[model samples]
Target: MVPLLVILLTLTGAWAGRPVLLPPPHAADLVLPPDQWFTQKLDHNNPGDDRTWQQRYQVNDTFYQPGGPVFLMIGGEGPATAIWVVAGQWIEYAQQYGALCFQLEHRFYGESRPTADMSVENLQYLSSEQALADLASFSAAMTEQYALPEGTKWVAFGGSYPGTLAAWYRLKYPDMVHAAVSTSAPLLAKTDFLEYKQVVKDSIYAKSGEQCYMNVQQAFADAEQLLEHPIGWRSLTSAFQLCAAFDGTSSLDGNNLMQILADRIESVVQYNEDNRAFSGHKDANITIGSVCELMNDESMGVPIERLAALNDLIMTVHEETCVEHRYQSLIDKMTDLDFASENNDATRTWIWQTCTEFGWYQTAEGAEQPFGQHIPLSYYIQQCIDAYGPEYVWIYGGYDQSFVDAAVAATNAKYGGRDLATSRVVLVNGSIDPWHAMGVIVSSDPALPAVYINGTAHCANMYPARAEDSPELVAARQQIGDLIGQWLQED
Candidate 1:
């Protein structure tokens, strides 16, 4: 059920059919953020795609400052809503910059859920194009129904998966949007499985400092090599997947391993903000978080367990306290480990399978990377590819993704400068982010620029380091933000 709220009136700039620009934080609406209400319901049913969707959006900005820009917030690959934990943050961004923020939830996420039978065919309708079209339609309807005030502009903003949508919106319907800000979003599709994997490895290694990383890598390698001979890698894969799941039970089997894998994935993607400042490093922000989290913590928490809905490969570092979400039926049959190197019959398979399977997975086009997730990029990229040409567009990756650099170069070279309007795709990377490439766009004409930030990880859509670094990083990020603010403030 949609949460009902009383809309705030008496906004500072709502008078005389024009906006009364409030001075930054002093704005009345901002100090007392309006209780933005939403109307969510299915808007269509595509029988061919076997899908139906509900559109949850805010329509009553009647009290909005007369001339403020209409800020539309778009979500990432998964299903999400404006009521998201981040809405207030976005509102702050808008209020700080003097714009009205309206968020749209992607399908199968949050409130914009799909009808029954959310199968592949049904999911197919959740493509980027469909999402954009939905946004366009929603805006048009809202504008007419609400009688949008004069001199209003529209801008889109998002990070990560949602960042991809923002970029796509700018490219697909340049006329509809004034400008967009995409943070830490790789324009390229999911092909960095390998690169992502490696970056996390290195980052974790670095975070632990030289000696710890060295020791751990060696241990992992030693463990990996040892398992290859005496027993099949399958046993190790199961062990890795199981240990990562932390369900620890007497019985461990293939099905249980898969379930554990699914649970791990659920928590990582559930979007835990605490992970960002947790200091203990539990954010689903990177593979290291996943691996680190799974390794550190064991029990399933309320958030990560939901990953089972997406897939069974979502392994993360278990470093937090969590609740149990599984039956643990097979946990009793599992054999225990002895640290002395006995052939871990059950856990070993999980370890071997994950190590082998994830490592073996290639890029969208089969290229390889050392550090990306075989799953996230591919799964998310499919959202765009399934709608646009499989290769009709371009994709870029960061060092954190598996073999992201190579995959990015390939995709960029293939699609870069291929066209003018849509050609000249760029893959931006953060030099410091192991999962990403050097914030450089290689796909567009002459290749896109790789914007760089020293001592920053994962392209930093929000780049917290900006506030904590040398004047150069701060200046650079400020300059970018300034450009965005300028564009936003215009027209």
Candidate 2:
């Protein structure tokens, strides 16, 4: 799954300047369902307050039989696309089991507006607690609306953050959902996610050769050395074709540039060999192998020079003129409170959740990682403070690292972190996906199976089957299907 925070950062010029790609068209034979809305509570915790908002949802009952199970496809930090109801591996499962399928857009994302604008006061209503409540309410409402049987079995399916929610939902409300399939879900809430980059480094070494890995490490080292000198800064600016000159003395600017460079490779590695149709890019074939081929090309000069050329190649693919390295530009874009703003709305919402509930900040503080230690945990904390305010940061206690640590701990405590003891919830992770480090890759309980695809990227099994799919991925899907079938039969 393409993380919503990364998408937002890319849009606001904080990360790599990659063009946002929409999901490719669904199967021609499948008919796309129309958007439907249900009234959801603004604050699920308050009983007296009757405030409500319109939550968007879609249903595809093309293969649903009268007494078959119901499949709920939970939306994540991004907008819920209609294509999900028509296509995806879950849709195939629905067809096989004659199950009714539904996709509900998360609050404050897509068209599910809970308030007029994204003011700090309004955003208080948006939380995972409230979202889970929304799901419960949605389930009861759907039952009444569709006249589903009292004991109808419901299976939850989600990927990425939604995947986390899917597992948590079953844990919190077992009666509502009988089974859950969580793909690439980070069960642990961490403040400094250094292991994320570590996994990326390992995946690079595993997919590409040692030379590619060494060159990437060397490139980051060289870039860090250049940032120390003013002349070197100018040279890098010219080579990378930056929109504005970077301040050599400012660590923030240096970190921004370094983070941007890291994001370029991270994105490629995170979605390595994922279906082009799922990624919605014509050149979705960009993989670790392709990136290694570029890095190993000696004609591009030194490692740093090759890195610059790679940046240029990414810009060319996205049709961007120059890389934006100014940190304040990113701040300005994220600080915009207008919900009507094109792309930053979803970013703002997700970032707020990260600050409040989950601190999944991917920092480069790990010693062994290829990326330099420029992007410290403080950079992300500062972003939260700048985007929201000191009040939001101080709400957890203080604006220091301890506050984030405490907040993440609270999140994990509320829901079982990595030691999630839930039944009939299959945890799925791709071995190459960086998020897997935080997920439950091994299960202690036989009922709670964990499927780790050997050579796959994020959400690889969530997408429809392909001829190029790895044998491991194919086997994982079959196992998941068999598990779901067994659960339904038991029900």
Runs of candidate 2 exceeding 4 Å displacement: 1-30, 343-345, 390-398
Q: On residues 271-309, what C-alpha lDDT tens digit does candidate 2 reach at each position? A: 788874554464476689988898999999999888988
In candidate 2, how many clashes are counted?
0
lDDT of 1 at 86: 27
What CA root-mean-square deviation does each model show from the true structure? Answer: 14.0, 5.1
Cα-based lDDT at residue 307, candidate 2: 91
Name the candidate that leads on lDDT.
2
lDDT (10s digit) by residue, model 1, range 270-338: 222211332223333544345444333335322222132122333334432332323232222112222
Question: Which TM-score value belongs to model 1?
Answer: 0.54
Q: Which stretches of candidate 1 lie over 4 Å from their true place?
A: 1-52, 58-64, 79-92, 149-152, 190-192, 201-213, 229-275, 278-429, 432-435, 438-451, 459-473, 489-491
What lDDT would each prediction earn against the true structure? 0.37, 0.78
